[model samples]
Target: MGKLPAADWTRREGLRQLTAALGAENLRWVGGAVRDTLLALPVKDIDGATPLLPDAVMERCRQAGIRIVPTGLEHGTLTAVLPEGPVEITSLRRDVATDGRRATVAFATKWQEDASRRDFTINALYAHPETLEISDYFGGLEDLDARRVRFIGDPHERIREDHLRILRYYRFQSRFGADLDEAAEEACAALAHTLKGLSRERIAMELLNLLGLPDPSATIARMRERGVLQVILPEAQACHVEALKRLIAAESTSGIAPNAIRRLAALLPPAPEVADSVAARLRLSRTQRGQLNCAASRVAQDAQNPRALAYTEGMDGAIDRLLLQGAELSALDGWQVPEFPLRGGTIVGRGVIAGPQVAAIMRAVERCWVAEGFPGPDRIEALLEEQLVQVLRDPSA
Candidate 1:
């Protein structure tokens, strides 16, 4: 057993009232909230499990004048929106059947059964909200202290229940697991093919989170060894691992927050068509697809001045393109990119009639300004004048 958090869990009035309404003994804080609290980590989404079914929980919430949303009701879960925050409550359950994607669960009254059906030991622990007492049926606290991510019961059986657990397993390992548990790793490698059965949306989300983890190089290396990476991202090359490593190092040294799509670009083959194929395969978001395509398209083109690239594209896009080119990270050190000073109106003011010519002259002058390292406003005006003289001299120049 593990000691509960030093901070009193019952201090919040809503939690106190909700506990009384649902019957404190019948409900205990469960899953990530409890796990995070015990580990002294930042807790989000205070979730709990109850012996009472979903409808009963809803009825109790209504009677208590608490706002209730029947979210995940089919899975025996509901949301109780309180002033402090929304707390997700679910009925204790056991898997009735599963199809490697969704599970049909039967509500259970025993805590042990609920704990047994979960994916990993660290996620199965429970804590009494009022008593601040801890419960451990699967030795989750020990695994948490050890930072070992072990699947509950048999790894193969757990993964067979939901193939998405294969990805989830790696995610947890990257964030929490001190080192890959041998049994879990072997099972994931053996069942890597099952990942294809999962939905593209789920695969995309899991991969994004995995890539966002600080220094996921080791986990990704293991994923490649287990053939998991090929199943999800066949377009990726093993040699790109070095590029990913450099990106991670750059991010750490520069204090830049993690960008999953940027890191994904580093792992992928540097080709625009490859990005298109991957974007389609993963069903990436419109914004994500655009970023991937832009980074891939610029891979072959050298960005001599990252500040100029940053001005043209956003800072994140510039960093992604530069990292792909293996450019010096120091180029991003005092990032200051001035906007091009020559707009259509500025060109029209130069006595050039505002029409296709104005637009063309603006484009031509802007190109020259960028090529000249984006000079100050006065210099930009001089360049614009020079382009105007050339255009007037030959109208076709």
Candidate 2:
């Protein structure tokens, strides 16, 4: 209800030009930016809503010589490219129909109708671009002030409109809500089975975002208690809440930001094969899948050979495993993983036969080296000779 700290980009020439062309009076800043600002949090993306339809918004941008992207034109959204970043300006809209997964919406001239259709009250708040005076028709400001994230209308009807709202509810609660709303929780639980109707990518994204919060352990535990977690991730039973508490504290003490895959990995069953199944079920990206599987695979090996784990899985994967196991993050400070010193040439130089024998001897020596904490290259020649001699004597050895 008062002036918010303005981002420098809001005053940039490109945004000013776009705002002037669109008629500043017709544009009402909306969504996350307004909610974040009102909560005294840093704003990232800026969004605005207008009564003008998509065509008029596009025409105004064209007239101003601004680049307009019809990012979601059918849904009445256009992104105006600015020097600072893209600001999405969507026309006011109301849901015409929804089937618990997708919505058919129609453009509207009334802000109240637009606000009424949003999933949560906190997300429905809007503000004046210049004055920063909030526009809250749905008690969003009151809910935000109380840190209570609630559905805009009836919880059951809202979830019925979009099953994805169940995940969205948990995501919002992880970040903004002090505690779960019992009605919203019951509605989400009752409709948890409908999560199967949503796409894997959408579910994966919301889960990742929820886990990426500063401390999502409690929120995730609650989701598990409410039977929502099992519906979305049937393979995942418990979140290892105690381990996750230590992991979160380690991240804070070490100034490491929360990582989604690592947090997800912490909650999963501690087996590489189980991680693989979970990744495939959630349709995680290749990199995320690899990191999670690598961490899971190395959890047991980390105790005796953290340096080797770091070498095999990379430093991040190794660290994630270590932290999740309640190890002090200081263990990784100044860690320089020593590389295996022997190569094929080194094996060949020892008079070992060139074919598979050389490869076999090299691998054996590397294993010994890893076991020995990767001693200096100066000592590798001796170790290689010892291994090669044993191989030659046994042949099958």
Clashes of each: 0, 0
Q: Rate the local accuracy (lDDT) of all candidates.
A: 0.86, 0.83
Writing each residue's lDDT as its tens digit, candidate 1 over 1-397 gives: 6657755454788888889899989888888878777777777778889999988998898999999998898899899998899999999999999999999999999999999999999998888877778899988888988999999999999999999999999999998989669999999999999999999999999999999998898888889988999999887678887788888887776677888998898888778889888898889999999999888877445567776687788777887787667676586677676766667887777787878998888788788887777778888778778888898898866
Candidate 1 clashes between residue pairs 3 or more apart in a chain or in different chains: none
Across 1-397, the per-residue lDDT of candidate 2 in tens digits comes to 5445575645668767877889977788888987887777887998989999999999999999989999999898999998778999999999999998899999898888999999999988877666766778888888887899999889999999999999999999989998658899999999999999999999999999998989988888888888998887766666465566667888888788899898887777688999998899889889999999977775554756667777777788878888777665565679887666667876777677788988878887788777777788777877877887798789877
TM-score of 1: 0.95
**What RMSD value applies to candidate 2?**
2.1
- TM-score of every model versus the real structure: 0.95, 0.93
Among all candidates shown, the one with the greatest TM-score: 1
Candidate 2 lDDT trough over 10 residues, lowest sum: 1-10
lDDT of 2: 0.83
